[model samples]
Target: MEIVKGSGFIPGDLLSKINSPSDLKKLNEDQLEQISSELRQYIIDLVSVKGGHFGASLGVVELTVALHYIFNTPYDQLVWDVGHQAYGHKILTGRRDNFHTNRVYKGLSGFPKRSESEYDTFGVGHSSTSISAALGMAVASKYKNLKDKQHIAVIGDGAMTAGLAFEGLNHAGVENANLLVVLNDNCMSIDPNVGALKEYLTDITTSHTYNKAKDKVWELLGKISKFGPNAQEIASKIENAVKTSLLKQSNLFESLKFRYFGPVDGHDVVRLTKVLADLKDIPGPKILHILTKKGKGYKFSEEGNETVWHSPGLFNKDTGEIIKVIPKTPQPPKYQDVFGHTIVELAEKNLNIVGITPAMPSGCSLNIMMKAMPDRAFDVGIAEQHAVTFSGGLASQGLVPFCNIYSSFMQRAYDQVIHDVALQNLKVIFCLDRGGLAGADGPTHHGAYDIAYFRCIPKMIVSAPMNEEELRNLMYTAQLDEVKTAFSIRYPRGQGVMVDWKTPFKKIEIGKGRKIKDGKELAILSLGHPGNLVTEAIERLKEQGINAAHYDMRFAKPIDEALLHEVFTSYTKIITVEDGCIIGGMGSAVLEFMADKNYSARVVRLGIPDNFIEHGEQVELYEECGFSPKKIAETAIEILKENKQTILKQGGTSLHDKQA
Candidate 1:
């Protein structure tokens, strides 16, 4: 094994040749410990400077080394859930040199991407999908008669609590496939996990029976491979023998027909390697639950707050101090923080108000309410479907539920949103954070489709806030008893335009848009945070003496018809912009309005194109999608240049004359 040189720390004496899993297999078993230590340090060095997910990757270093060492990867498939712990996996799988570029623009993806490498069997960003994806590969291998191929799903305990994981387990139990689900029980999912499953898994881990019988169960499992043809029979005997103690209480996986094993120490690389090697010999469908800490090996990470350290951007590795850009002036707060603080303020006055999120208490900033009024806020664990229906139930009982979910993740619970909320016309105000291009996390995490998806739903109020003030106002209006049907308030990931954002909460009339400025040449219509970008473009256009009107169209659904009439009857050239998809978005809604009113104009729609965007900074992605201030200005200039040509060809009829 030869060292693939990366930019940062690579221990010169050790881990010199671990280029890939095949290269890793060349080294002696005893050397695995040295490799694990080096691997952990390598991640710490790179992530401290370059910035990506920490703790989660640090926790799984030993398990990562053990899995790649045992399994013949790129041939024997391995799927990761969420890919938070995939940095070590990426480094070990010939990406050591590229580690520094992990979530940067046009570099390697933060998550497992099938296009980038052959080793990443399934592209993953969201949680609880490893089981489903890995099971499909296992079933396909069975069909092709690939007898030697082993399929493994490395899923965390937090991901295990989701409905899809159990659904996969149920189906895998019935199918005669060579599948192994390695449950990395680290008691976390961005934030610490909650719900009944957390306690159930905790019960299995703490029980004396599991600890006492674990060795005997492994001893019997070790002997099964030696039985050759009778391995299945011996495996059944071993499983039946442990049913009295371990299986009786730990029937969650066992009842699903998966042979349950371990609550083993995941840090012990040697033991993990031996156990994983043993499981390979006797497996139809089985699960190995291994215990681990969220941030292992690093002293600072081990002691620090787990949620904050999950993705602590640009930190001092030596000092263990997180780097922050201390502005000279008091700047604007993040849109999510505004939502968090504003919700608590609203809940204080309204007894019927409640808050809920799908395990993103910290990420979405709902932890504010959870801290202030614990009874009012709830974190439902990694179940997007359940979160929507649960909110609907609350709304049905005359209680208002501000169900917050990331824009991209809401795609998973579309059926529930339609059936449980909108169909019943329940008053569930969905606070969609990361409602546009979510930087670094890439396509799977990007909240680009929410505007398009929610626009068509009947009895649904689709809205986006241009600033923190509008965000608070939208929240205030949605929860009011006068407003009917479910409401959605989509906002961006970063800080808003206003520094002094905590204004008195005001009720915005539903579907009414405010005109920022009026012009004679053409008008620019914008939705959500991108309306701020349109404001910048207007400044640039003013320099060229190209007067462009700007409108902050607050609502996409029941789109301000009064404003549309003013826009269409006055202007022949129009531009619509959003931080979402172009197809069936706010832009499309504007075009539909024009057609219905028999108003003709050269309408240009700018947003996320009909393709999945890659990982990059938000500015880089916005430019690539042609919706950045610069790009938006360029579009406006190009439209005017073309209109100038049309002016000359049509007997020199000016834009002002046409509008008049």
Candidate 2:
């Protein structure tokens, strides 16, 4: 409860005494406990000062310390599911110096990156991947005859609900792989976990009466088996019979062929180390379930009002009050907020409207709609595939279902979107939030590939809103029965440039693009939040004595040929920019158009690079990727200059010469 400063902890001199897991070997058990306290306090201070995933890191502080102290990391291969809980892992693994720059540009990444450090065994961002990945490593080690090396996967109880986790469990159990799966049961995900599995775990962890009865049964069986060696055989049959019945009612993990261990006290470092030491020697798909509270050590964070504290902004460490930024005169709502509020308004008018999200009610702002219409909005709990298919079922029943999922998370449900929604041509509105470069959360959170992936699917309508007003209108348009096709509207993460919400809802003529500006020398086509950058680029071009036309081609699919034809006829050069991969994105559509029609206008495409983008501030990343207004304008000018040279060389009248 008390505010623990970094100064009170053991100084750097003591920390410097330990370098690796081998270095931790010298520390006594009591010293290891001090190390855990120091590590927890360090995490509290680090996250409190420079905001990242706080609660996840706080909950795993002791576990992380115990694992490092007990196991030979980097060599032993410790894989963490979800990676949000890797802050303490980072601290102990020689990244303590760079922890201050966590999640910032060119600094420590928010998630595990294999290239970042040798200790980070596998790069992880999405959840429920550790078990399968760790098993693969274990199998590889066996194939190479390196059976002495250990493989451990620390997954949360919430992560265990994911079907992939169980699939991995089944395979590992069947193979009898030497793998340790430590289930960190904190009784929460980003939000509290849902579905039948969560409730089952809750029963196992909380049911004292059931546990007592089971203990009594075991004791009675022991007494009966003591009569003779033959009685032991009878007792085994009885135990198996009772287990079979109990498995039908509870304990899903044991049924999946795992030796389920305790729901132990996760915060107790000494106990965890002892258990882990014991488990290390005997392991074949064994699970040690540990119970820990999120935001365990820090009182204020534990009782914080908002999940904003889960990954909070800059704040006062003492009081835990988020530092309030000076309010501007008026601010536009976040794109997610607009989408959330719009869906609720639409749902109010249409009783058939239903909202769904995959463990992201708060992140996607679907919580707003959920609050307004609790019966209609459902949180499917990190199961994107289920959310999509569930929405498909709802749509089949003649209901308008809106499945709100983050653009990054939607990757998990790609097959479902194709087979269940698009192939079936279900009237489901896929509201994709965080469609572009999501800043602090890093590469895994960037919604860069949604456009390319969704565009190829048959019967799929892909659209991006240039502003908050267009976003609202697009959501309204997608709701219409006439737009019965499966539709997706992707918008970025932050506020919508303070745009007023006075724009009335109307169906945008499908695939139609609106020209925001008129010019002669060059044309600029833009989509999503990057349309603002287009406007800025156009202004900069005008200042440089270049006439540039700008168009907000809202829908990526149905390629606005009419608008393209207009630009093809009017302009000598065309340039396209979007916050997505250029390979098969809006720019590719334009290039395909030019190629199909045999139009010869010089075209330039600017977008995210072909490689994976790392963690950084959004502005810094955009500027680095050449998506900024200044960079786009400069690139446009260079392209236009080359266009004039080509015309001159071809003996055609150049725009510059004609103007002169």
* Model number with the top TM-score: 1
Q: In lDDT terms, which candidate is top?
A: 1
lDDT of 2 by residue, 7-98 (tens): 23332434555556676778888887787777777777767667788888888888998999888888899999989999889878887766
Q: Which stretches of candidate 2 lie over 4 Å from their true place?
A: 1-16, 210-250, 648-651, 655-660
Candidate 1 global Cα RMSD: 1.6
> lDDT tens digits, residues 267-338, model 1?
999989888988898759989999999889988989989888899999999999999989999999999999
Q: Least accurate stretch of 10 residues (summed lDDT) in model 1?
A: 3-12
Query: Model 2 lDDT vs. the true structure?
Result: 0.83
What is the TM-score of candidate 1?
0.98
Clashes of 1: 3
